[model samples]
Target: MHLVPLIECAGKGFPDGFYEFKNCDSFKLLKEAREKQFVSYLNIGATWKPWHLYRSTLPFTPMSSPFHKLYGHLSDPVRIFTISGEFTGHRIPLSEDLLNARMVMEAKLHNLPEQVDRQYSSTSQSTASTTSLINIVDPETKDEVQFNDPDFRNGIVTCAALSLDGHHVALGFGSGVVELADIDHQHTISRFQLDPPNHPVWIEFVHGSHRVAAEDSEGNVTILSHDMTAANLGNLPSGPLPAVTRVSDNGLFIIRVPRNTDSSWYDSLTLVSILGDPHLQHLAPPSSNNFTPTSNPPILASEPSTSSSASIKSDAVLTIPHRRTLGFSPGAHYIGAFDGLSAFTWSTSSGELISSYRVTDFNLWIMNPAVPFTCSYRIPDPVSPRPTLSLTEGEAAHTHYSETHAGHNLDSSWIKCPFYVLLPSEEEWDELTMLDIHSSAAGRTPLFGTNGKRQRLPVSFNGKLEFIIPKEYEPVVFSGAKGLGAWYGDRVPFDPTFLYSPRSSKDGTRILLQGWQTAPIVVDLSQVI
Candidate 1:
């Protein structure tokens, strides 16, 4: 494997810099295997989230089988679920052995009906003490704990969700049961049932608040309030939305509802706020968890002369239109939605919308049927400081529970929600244009620099249709961000480079292309330099 940098300049002069290429040790081996046979198709779950899980199912022959003809007839599809909820992508293989069974589900999509439960047992191993909840540590922070609560010991936990803060988790089971488990406890702290048993597709807990919301199989969304200091509210009157039909992603109180089954869903995200004063219709602040009044007794006072007084109420504040998907900028000021692969930004507080940026062909594309399109965002670094704060605030700040917490700086951080689907573009499709050997446009490319200046690269792709970067952009190989950008477009099918943004602070700086599964041999970038 060769690691070469490209510095190409045309109109002016070649920029003086180094193009670093990081090579993964296993690239060449994996490439040969992929060419020979389809070992497996791996997909990254969430690009920007701390907990990055990669799903891959490989078909392989089993060693043992009862029926002679069935032996070779059946192929087991194994899934590799990597736990990167933390920074480092530490992987643990979840197969029959880890789950103490012969097989796990092949796909991550939980929409499959409840009948699939009977095929697998949640409590198969003899040494297991419990049937459902499995506790695991965050791969990045060894001290952080993660809980995987399987509903009903069944094959599917449809509405399982982890809070943005990684402190709480909620799960809607196959049996129409909804349960909330505290990450700190690693056990179910509260449980409830939706009157009619329906599968819950997804759930989202307010980042820093006690309230948690969930969506059922029938498209109904219900929000529940939890008592502070672990007080049992028992069962409170739940606020339900009748017309949602289906819910995709849920932020503090915001959610995405598809307009219909078709590819073109609503292009706006919904924001629901439960208020303290129901009748006033005016939003009331959620009770603060950290507030503790002094025990000093006060003298009773006579009733005020006023005729009307404040009343307690709960209400829902929603963002006007339904969006395909909603995401918060690194700084909470900007909320975004994707309309047909094009991303639009909005001021969460002022409702002021920003111009849309298109990532369609670059990030979204239609490939062969076998190679389905997968999209996800890269979670920023949690510890890295944000660049600057925004001036305006969205209504979401006033109505969302995450906003009520003192420790959580909801105003400073953003949540990335990525959407991926198979739909044709409205714009005219452009066919691949093969550039001539001496084409001037060949070297006309954007250069990424640490100082934010455009410098000419000393090299180019020579003229290959595409380039393939390494799985993780390692420091030893990549010299600057521009080299990573050039490596991205040059890489043929996919960019193996994984980018990371700081979690709390907002900045545009992202990690570049790291390394590849195969070393550069026949199509090396040495000539351009």
Candidate 2:
């Protein structure tokens, strides 16, 4: 694997005037800025700035000043620039000083509306008015706009998603309410209440459409359209609510329902088509032994089974035990799911399992749409024993051909597919090991001076599979890089933290890695492999 360092900020030491090298626990990349040939990192904390990928660091714009104290807890902070893109929203702390400072700077910089509303927090001093603001700077016009919600002033927002068009945002709150906010006018367009006693567990804006999908803790999936029409997509068979719901870029939705009943062996992963039928259908991974289909168009169940409660046929059902992670290929042609130890890929069109591999500590898997390539080859004369034939063809054909092939020897290649999978190193497994320490300690006898003699768990790359495309296909190859410990120098043992989930840029060209005790590492994929 090839490693290219793009941007590295000090985790322990830094020069004066620079943001203190505190543990960078979280960060997000500004893809909008990236499109403008700039790479910016929004490090969560006092230091929030944009840096140029190729030039000197951009000017640091501090939201906090020494003179004023920002009050109150911040909820979700969202980016409000892109017209049709994700990553437009983020959560920022709710501070009076920060809000007012941002308001003044935005109004002056973007010529926004001048009327600033000051509302006092009931918990704060009566003499002081706490600022509660929701502001975003328009990327196209550089104008700042404020979006206001009564709930923002009182209720706590649990989760939020910004629409691709940047025209709307959907926010799920702890009060069991979901709200759609219009960004241009800065007001709530609509609000829908979920079943009582259950807060929203997940909420997402369906891409390429004006719809939103939200799921509550009660295992109920709610679909909200642009017209404010709300419909329940029906709760899955009585079980634990899905761990998470993901909306593919193509608008298909997937939910991972955990196994709560004794009859089930593993969690059930289901898929739904928001643009078509809204039924929740089970997604089963193909048998590991049956990676390839037996036929061109695999035979499907002849009729829907009456024995099953699902509207879909029994043979159509795909089940994977303990499957938690789910992802759709770029164009929705394939769906990939991973249990803790293995990964499987399924063809969406034929409802057939295409590939399955044992993976060790799978971190990230990305399958871009298959690109088509055409290769033209000259037809050699079968009767000719010319040595020149070696120049055009790498090797001689051994297959016996019918009379029809007597004149033809040329073949044309049609399509090529590429994919990438990232795996974590043994050191990355330290978090898991720490959790197992208690169980191991209970099973072993302690012996003084022999502590260092205990055998360390062996690390294996067994299930960690990497793909190699054939040379005839000439597909784009992605290299993998693991082990960030070497980058820490003497601070290896004290690394202490790592992001549970690494954040990737919108274009998937860059990834942002932040941890509690580590400085943020931004890896540029374009420069790597």
Candidate 3:
């Protein structure tokens, strides 16, 4: 379907600074499965690899695409999978290094089957009043605990899981250690080691129970189920790598349980949604209506049914080739690998492919939502080197100087941000094409001096882009507003400005939104009458 750009939420002019989208008439919203209480998805951009800079580096040359050193020419044809989303709103940035940071966190936290508690401890110099702690709870006992470790003290916690009853929480780390925490009281329940020929790439908890699943770096999926004693669960090896086996080192691993409950075995299959090729379903059945019937149907005979030629095909296993990547969605729907794209949802009772959708390319890294603001601070610019003074001395002397210029338009509020960084792909360097999520949207705005350099489209919520920044903008200092930034889609040449969360008033008629100039913008998305 053609992508459509939206011009207005309901007509009245869009808030200033934030560009508006020109709605697309050709595209229709895919609402076949959408519901207010239905599936929620969290799209995340993958992390940046260390070599990405070198690969994108050019040799004394100015090229359109950055990675001329690595890709050579093969980069042109390949379309990289990008974008990650969750219920909590946020925007993924264009920086590659930040992307890697998010991915490492997600792989560590989401590789399990059950839901657990999570605690975030930031190391940023900012005070607690600014950067708040994030807590995850167990769905069962309602037990809550702090899951953050000393290692991730300052960094963000991207992925996490709690058991069906909230008995345990599997927390993933950038160091590749999957920490399984018990939520009864604050304590280290047990740490499952995935370090070996295959390191722990992802972790997850089984549905409705404490059964946890962890994927090794080799793409091997190992299920850990609890015994009746309510003790530490043992691992049940599903097999050496199913379709999701291709995601190895440099790949992402995530797990999810089924959320849709309209099936017969809704609780049985624990349908593990694998991100791969949505088109694969069509390839398997030739058509959704096509499936070969078993050679023989099961028969309930009165006289102790005797075995016969071509035994009743009561049990059946059908393998369909499709693409899958590691990801997560509402109701615990998870994609199990880090490679390819498209994720699948299947019927647990019949092992039949139920439905599918294209996963936003971000599964390689983080799965998060937007955060709130706190404070603001500024750093002085470095001094220029003089002829006689050493460069170090000049830098030190100038590092404390403050420069404040008006019209910089730096202050702005961002809302519903799912922060991420831009990193290089597994292959080689290629041009960065920031295609609009609303396909029909216009090309990215050129940054003037860059001569039409394209910016990747920022990930947004319901077509809105949000940025994170400080609550108060003071002078030229860098604001601590690292929350989510928002922008309007469907508008061409969208501004580089950020949008903030909509603040409601006591009367609820006028809504205050963060504006591009770091000021409050009032918008009315809903009908006042």
Candidate 4:
């Protein structure tokens, strides 16, 4: 496998830098993620405030499974219930794990229907917890937490996250204040401050664990207790301190984005203990982890481990081109990222670059069924695993969650949700090109030998699935007109700066797509996928 720096891959004259300063003083993405905590603050669009604010990528969360795991066969939409309330438009979830937890306190009478009690049984399946939130709040919920000034006051809310139970909300203020508030009672439960005034830019309640991972403005993470306090067990470390970090959906791992000393763009992605320093476990021995002779300007491993809370000591590093999105396959079997037209996958067990593939076809935006088109597109579902005799095993269609029963052998295989989908950037915005994730990334291919071959592919570099906006509802640039109304046979125009804005259902059956200037619509993936 031969890889080069993203800049070298681009040839001459690449423009723009990767780093940007995101502050709470004007960021709306943080504000929107917290709006549900304070129902009244969920503003839909641009406000009339004199000062303009940075519009956030909308907080459109896909619904998790609400039914018992036994009913895994139900179609994606049927297996769940919407977060019944003002957030209906956002399509939140009732969340299965929450249903199994004991009732903290008797739910408000209005929120829980009386009929639910009669339906409950010790031997029967669980639905009481789910029923307790039906029509929980008005579609137009009453205002609660109001900002001093909509422009900047609201922006002071640096970041927000909801507990797995969806009963608590943790908000980080610009003043380095972290508040843990109860969503059910609309009141503050606890508040704390970070030393030396570090502002949190992102916060997430780690699922399946009693920890809160807060990434500060400078990209340093502080692990807090479930009650929002400095705690004993900390996060698994992934980067040298001060590297930008992103947590997984399951909150089990962290991926660190450390910038290349040579360039402004990040040349590699280090998954912190999940993407860290001394306390973190670094992959042992350079010989154990091997990188295929890919990537131009061969990266030299930088070590001499530093000792800091945010520092990491890595023995093996798989440096690739500039990457943005990071994901893990189920059980974190494989880790990879999309850098430009290339896809790179690594083995978690060996910490080696197992396979890499570059897309040969660029115009893979439409889906044709009679006989599938694009090499990236994985059409027609097979009933069972069929044998295939192809050498390009690295470039097969990725395994969609719906297909594998999401890892059938695993316990609770019916409802596993891993963050593995990839959305590459493109010039057009009306359509979404999905570099879908596969379940297994366990394959091997010989190095670029003299057998006359192209680059080696990932254990799996399945093609792609592309869906466009229904012709009836195209995205508008200004006053909502369809495709710039051209008679010269021009193609439909799109918002080039899509900012990775689409949302997919937990089951991977439906992807909700809403353009900047258009109403929301869903791509029914059940048919094609």
Choose 1 or 2, whichever is better by TM-score. Answer: 2
TM-score of 3: 0.24
Candidate RMSDs in order: 23.1, 20.6, 30.0, 23.2
Model 4 bad stretches (over 4 Å): 1-155, 162-168, 182-190, 227-246, 258-268, 273-324, 347-352, 359-529
Q: Write the per-residue lDDT of candidate 1 for residues 1-529, one digit (tens) a residue.
A: 2110100111122234311221442333233222322211112111221111111111111123121122222212221112211211212222222233112332321322222222222424445322222232112121011012222123334434444444444555445565665534334556666655665554556434355666565655566555632212122111122112111123433434332212222232344433332110111111111222122112121121011231111221111112113344433344545322334444444444333333333223211111112322232121212223244334345454443343123433333222222332333123211121211121221111111011111111222222122223211122111212111101211121111111110111111121221011011121122
Rank by lDDT, descending?
2, 4, 1, 3
- Candidate 1, superposed: residue stretches over 4 Å from native: 1-155, 228-251, 257-263, 274-326, 339-341, 350-354, 357-361, 364-529
Give the Cα lDDT of each candidate: 0.28, 0.33, 0.25, 0.31
TM-score of each predicted structure versus truth? 0.34, 0.41, 0.24, 0.37
> lDDT tens digits, residues 232-298, model 2?
8888553322243445544554544443324332225566645344656665544333443222112
Q: What's the best-to-worst order under TM-score?
A: 2, 4, 1, 3
Candidate 2: which stretches are off by over 4 Å? 1-64, 67-154, 207-209, 237-242, 255-267, 285-325, 349-352, 360-529
lDDT (10s digit) by residue, model 3, range 1-529: 2111121121233346433332332111121101101111122232222222122111111223222322234211211111231211112221243346545544554522232212222324534432223242221122111123322211232233434333344554334444554433434445444444233433545432344556543434455444422222222233212212111111112322211113211122233322221001111121242322222212222111111121222331111111111222211111221111222333211334333323233312222211221111121111211122122332332233222111012111110111122234333124322221221121111111000112111222222332111111111111111111111111111111111112222222222222221112222212311
TM-score of 4: 0.37
Indicate which candidate wins on lDDT.
2
The digit string of per-residue lDDT tens for model 4 on 1-529 reads: 1111221332332235311423432222222223312111111221221111111111122223121121223223211112232211322322232222112111322232333343333344865464453433211111111112122222244455545344455656545666665444444565566554555655655543345666664545666664544632233322222233444444455555443344312234454332212122232221222322223323332221111111221322223221123454443444544332344444443445534434223122111111212233322221221232121231132232233223223212211211122223453223422223111110110000000011111111123312222222222111112112211100111111111222232333443322221112333333434
Q: Which ten residues in a row have the lowest lDDT in candidate 2?
A: 488-497
